[model samples]
Target: MKTLILTTAALALSAGAALAESHAQTVRLGTEGAYPPYNFLNDAGEVDGFEREVGDELCARAELTCEWVTNDWDSIIPNLVSGNYDTILAGMSITDERDEVIDFTQNYYPPAASAYAAPSEDVDLTGGVVSAQATTIQAGHVADSGAALLEFATPDEAVAAVRNGEADAIFADKDFLVPIVEASGGELVFVGDDVPLGGGLGVGLRESDGALRDTLDAAIQSMKDDGSLNELIVKWFGEDAQTFE
Candidate 1:
């Protein structure tokens, strides 16, 4: 979905050990409170979405006290490395570039495709301007798609860029774009074929937090084994959403 930078490699290593030792305390869960159906701010201003539900359940299964902390998508990874939070459960896709900076639990959400949304199907996807949230795989894809890439700080802004004619189309997760397109009442429509990206969405952790990563991975595996994880995916993403076998 999105990418981020990291620092404090030396500190990240030690932080994991300390976090592992202090597992009984509240394990801070980091998330970008912007993406919907993944992680977003609820009406009460609390983190709420598919990831939140899955994260809460994982914490319960792991017997860990966890709390959600919101952060900007661009800084989510750097903050984790700097110990701002212990884990990132914000629908971050697992990619090779990201793995070099941080650790990820086995995917809680399966890989999904990215798609384009435009005011019309005639928008030139290959030769015209495209909008995407900065630091996201979508933006990266846009940069390489022979289209002019317009980067925005947030997904909403990126979509706005398209609606306001600042760009020809917006590229993002199909899951994220579905409701927006449907709610647009014909103002927006899906354009082009869906582009599959990344391994899947997993819990991101500091590179040093191997123990915490392993623990979370175990919890995720348990959910998958018993089918509760599939239930949660279906509950949040609808009947057509992907589920574990």
Candidate 2:
């Protein structure tokens, strides 16, 4: 989960309910292309992953023509307010702090725990330096904890900080970290306890787009009702991942 505080002007734009909607029938979905399983660039250099599939399905159900757009994680919300996109389908958790800047559809993915990964089991989580993507809940948690927080621009960079010994461990979404730890082939291992955070991952939109939010929320609920959303969650995050059901 990630969040960036928007400027006062950006908040003003997001709060303006009467702003002219310029996209017509096409809704542009924004995502961070580096977060695997959630969203990432495929071999074809197109946005592809769990969120992509879900987003496409939602758009189809909502009868909205949609396009995918990628942006850096740190600037995602700001860009959304700036009209770079109409919706944010990134792995964004629903939190009060974020609600002040953007509206969210009901979560498609259930609340998942955050975990720590390290090269060894003995790393001291309470006092050691832990790496996390800047502006993420994990980073906020680490900064608040007794551990020294090391911030990076991306998840890969955070993991690299641990691997290269710049940090003692990397803390991130448990769902996002699991595949990386598994593929690390024992080079990296889960450590410490899991920390549950946020309400779950949902589609983020501007307050001015309440109509669009309702449309997407209904689509997401339809998927949940038919169990297709659960199927997608398992498809990308494995059987252990949380589901709406």
Top-TM-score structure, candidate number: 1
Clashes of each: 0, 0
* Candidate 2 residue-pair clash tally: 0
lDDT of 1 by residue, 3-60 (tens): 1112232234344445556755789999999999899998999999999999998776
Q: In model 2, which range of ten residues has the least summed lDDT? A: 1-10
List all candidate RMSDs to the true structure. 7.2, 7.8
- In order, candidate lDDTs are 0.87, 0.86
lDDT assessment of candidate 2:
0.86
Q: Which residue ranges in model 2 land beyond 4 Å of their true spot?
A: 1-23
Off by over 4 Å in 1: 1-22
In candidate 2 the C-alpha lDDT for residue 123 amounts to: 96
What is the C-alpha lDDT profile of model 2 across 1-245, one tens digit per residue? Answer: 11221232233333222222444556899999999889999999999999999999987766677899999999999999999999998898999989999999889888899999999999999899999999888888899999999999999999999999999999999888988899999999999889999999989999998867867776776677668999999899888777774
